[model samples]
Target chain A: MQETRLDTARIRAARQVIDPIFLDTPLYRCEALEPVLGCAVSIKLETANPVRSFKARGTELVASLLAGRAAVCASAGNLGQALAWSGRGRGLDVTVVASRFAPAAKLDRIRALDARLELVDGDFDMARERAAAIARSDGIRLVEDSLDIETCEGAATIGLELVDAAPPFDAVLIALGGGALATGVGHVVKTWAPGVEVICVQPLGAPAMTHSWHQRRVVTTDSTDTIADGVAGRRPIPAVLDDLLVVADDAVLVREESIVAGMRMLLDHAGLVVEPSAALGIAAILEDRDRFADRHVATIVCGGNVDMDAYHRWVGARS
Target chain B: MQETRLDTARIRAARQVIDPIFLDTPLYRCEALEPVLGCAVSIKLETANPVRSFKARGTELVASLLAGRAAVCASAGNLGQALAWSGRGRGLDVTVVASRFAPAAKLDRIRALDARLELVDGDFDMARERAAAIARSDGIRLVEDSLDIETCEGAATIGLELVDAAPPFDAVLIALGGGALATGVGHVVKTWAPGVEVICVQPLGAPAMTHSWHQRRVVTTDSTDTIADGVAGRRPIPAVLDDLLVVADDAVLVREESIVAGMRMLLDHAGLVVEPSAALGIAAILEDRDRFADRHVATIVCGGNVDMDAYHRWVGARS
Candidate 1:
């Protein structure tokens, strides 16, 4: 609604401030997977970092801004872990409010990083409310993932790196959640590579952002059921959606089956153990082969943080 | 053997010639895995590349030298793929001889890279002999993986990058096959970081390299039986062993079960789909926890190229 603070200058500045671990991630063409996916795919892998996700980029910058102050946030899992990890090194106390259904692997990691965790009984929306209330009562900053300008700007560093390094692509498909990654990356790509399409992909089971983007208004879903906990959102952040509407060329929804297949394909062809959220781009390719057929496409494999047991079930279900 | 030529200077020079895709791989301490592995573990991830292995470093450097000349080499899988990839772009004809038992995933990739593939009936030793025959008959240079100074020197770049980038570590355990990775990394680590112990690890099923390093001579086994095809060597290259002996502080053999368990552990904790060879360092730690407990240890995840069916069987067998 107000003047946008997320710009190329801030993202370039964030690159200097973000931890080196989250910067300069692996971006390479997946020749091994091209024949099967029917597209020349270049993966900007965000999984190889310490947090095994791209959240560290934003969280690190956000943590730096909150020098000695306490911060609170709600996450499905990755954001909490990223905040905990970033906060630990800076002596910044962080409390994460998460849905009770959040993966055990992430909860354990959050505690391992010495962060206080509060679990809400209902969905992510409920957890967000709890986090806001905690921040308000305790007089701490509520660092929202997508709503925070610094967080989105920090994430925009990924786009800066991608446009600078990745091979020429016709379109770039990004996994859409609360829109930090999509909006951040979309902003840079649209700004620099205007011709390249910035497509956002969300799981069909949780299509809040996808619906909101198409309608140009905030859309809320009744429930979220996807295994892709990272992108499983019910309530869309209106501010993030406004930004996404401007940068996103198109938004696509993928099936549950396709997500599992995408994960298996990555593990089999590319030797990557991508989580459900990370596989969204690949899932999009699987669902609509004709759209990406023989075209050069780039996608950010944004995370790899799935429980082993859950991973086994997802990959093992089909074959 | 002649005076050694693989050194840090050569490795430093090789870094300039080798493809940037293989240089400066992700080397970070896996905090998530430290609790389970009983040590501060840093993984030099070599899987996130075109060839999906560390072999590209040597192969790219070697390919540059044979600009217009044809070359032949024998490989279990990864070296062939790397050579094929490097050679494809350089217009240099390349031939790879491999055992029929080599993973289909690798064989398919080798062919995809447009290299001539020769399948031998027996083992890696038989493939090596066949490759030698081809080189002699065709009047082409036989590029040996470990014996070649250029190849080993190329691999030594990993050591240079590791020492230059990674945090302080007490020891580094590398997978030992023909000894390119182990000897190359050992040379750099021993030369520059003299205090850091350089250990070589091999599968107990194929202990020729370990035995040869210990005895200070070549040791040939009757057969090699291991799921880690990348490091399943029965014949130890004397030249590589000579170099390995000077740099290696210790040589350890890990059980087959331990190697499988290591792969699973890396998959679960580190979010890596490492092949059996890549897991050797983790396997070594798994076997001798006391040897690495509370110590900072670094290990190169050398490769990740295994058949999906086989990968499923390995990770699925126990769980």
Candidate 2:
């Protein structure tokens, strides 16, 4: 089967629009984690953004594209803040529909970004559905995570940066969420650094991508729960699934406890404050350190939008 | 009085030793704060390091310069972890003398950096005295904070980056500790952008630099306390004092409450997790927002090495 490729022209155009507002997050060698893994390891720090997440890149691109249109989206956390901030920059109205489960700090952030907040009933799926309906009714553009090609392209820039900054790695561990980040990053790595393995890591409780990969089709679950709130989801977007299948060499589901451990490792060793989803790749590595031993690896610290309360709980729970 | 000029040749040589190990942190426009400040506000994000602080640069430089020599340093938090990490990288034995007041997580980080940790009996002063004694008695190279010219030059790279990255600003806000960061940054800013204002910000409770500036001489106090632990000191080093006096346009003392507010603001608006010292400049801005309402301004986010427990307490206290 032919691999589905990103529209380079569209990506280039989106890059031009988003370049001014977005940051080119740095890619640096993780000397500390290297010895533990027994391989040369580098980390692409996407947490350095003004919004402290990679969602800034995707949402910035989406917001820029919808310059004249009202922008709407549903997010668990980081995406809402990103969209709200980007929308504020462009002088566009933004409405964020968030699940009740979303952190108070994240909701506060969305409001701080000057976005109209809608607290929806039920989980993320229901919130997203409500957002989509509002967008359709109000003639606003719903910047759905899976449907936005620009979001994926924006994320692909990470792969581009990694390939440009560091030597070829044996594997790239990416946290799988709406699949845009993994699919986009995987596309670039598989295409440009063909020898490098691309591993998509998902939370065990929400293994939509893993299930999709095994079944060779898009999959969705009725119920999903995980500590990695950013990547906790049921549905796999078909467009992203096609790209993930083509580009990803393997998939791993990390335990929640390990994810907490990864977060602790990040804080203690790397001095990084990352959310559970951001630590998913590290969690995967921690699960079977020997498997990644003696192989050059790169893991994306995708976001740092964890709420203070959640962080306190996780730290307390882990300690 | 003449300024203590940075030895550019030495800084250039030091860069060769340190560049590979440390990140060249970004100097970019603070878009969110700029409109409020009414001047072009830029910030140097030195917090995007392994230790999540600018101390990494100085520690790396000092460690590399020490070559095969054993190293010792006294730190509130960031410096110890930085030295530990850099020392480990070079296979040098490192001992960090930290005060009991320092964060537990910071001690963990120092250990994680593979350094020998020594918890001192008292505050940062006692830690410094102990480190100095150890270095002298054991023939280990002491990576003293303000007294070391190399450390200052290493930090001066922040100024160099700022000058190269952004156009000249009217003022630059720096949080002063033992004065290494302020002196280094001030030296470069004054040399490169002569017209730029250099404002030194100190916590009201720990006003070593402020007292020195007022008395027109180095000042010392028996004890000092402030939420901005990174900048909380009772004495100013004479080596940095002369340069600080010559280059620093003025100095401001920020209230503890304002500094806490600044931290929350960064987390809320800028999506940044900054320690109190890093927020001092922003705190100063917020304190007198009308004064800076319309000026081209720049500030350094010196470090991000706050204790989680301390952070929780500070935020809780503020609320």
Please compute DockQ, using alpha carbons, for every candidate against the native two-chain complex.
0.53, 0.20
lDDT of each: 0.89, 0.79
What's the CA RMSD of model 2 in angstroms?
Answer: 4.5
For model 2, how many clashes?
A: 3
The parts of candidate 1 lying over 4 Å away from their true place are: A1-4, A317-319, B1-3, B317-319
Which candidate leads the pack in TM-score?
1
- Candidate 1 chain B, which ten residues in sequence have the lowest lDDT sum? B1-10
Best by lDDT: 1
Per-residue lDDT tens digits of candidate 1, residues A26-81? 88989988888988999999999888999999999889989788999998899999
After best superposition, candidate 2 residue B201: deviation in angstroms?
A: 2.5
lDDT of 1 by residue, B56-134 (tens): 9999888898987899999999999999999997878999999999999999999999999999998888999999999
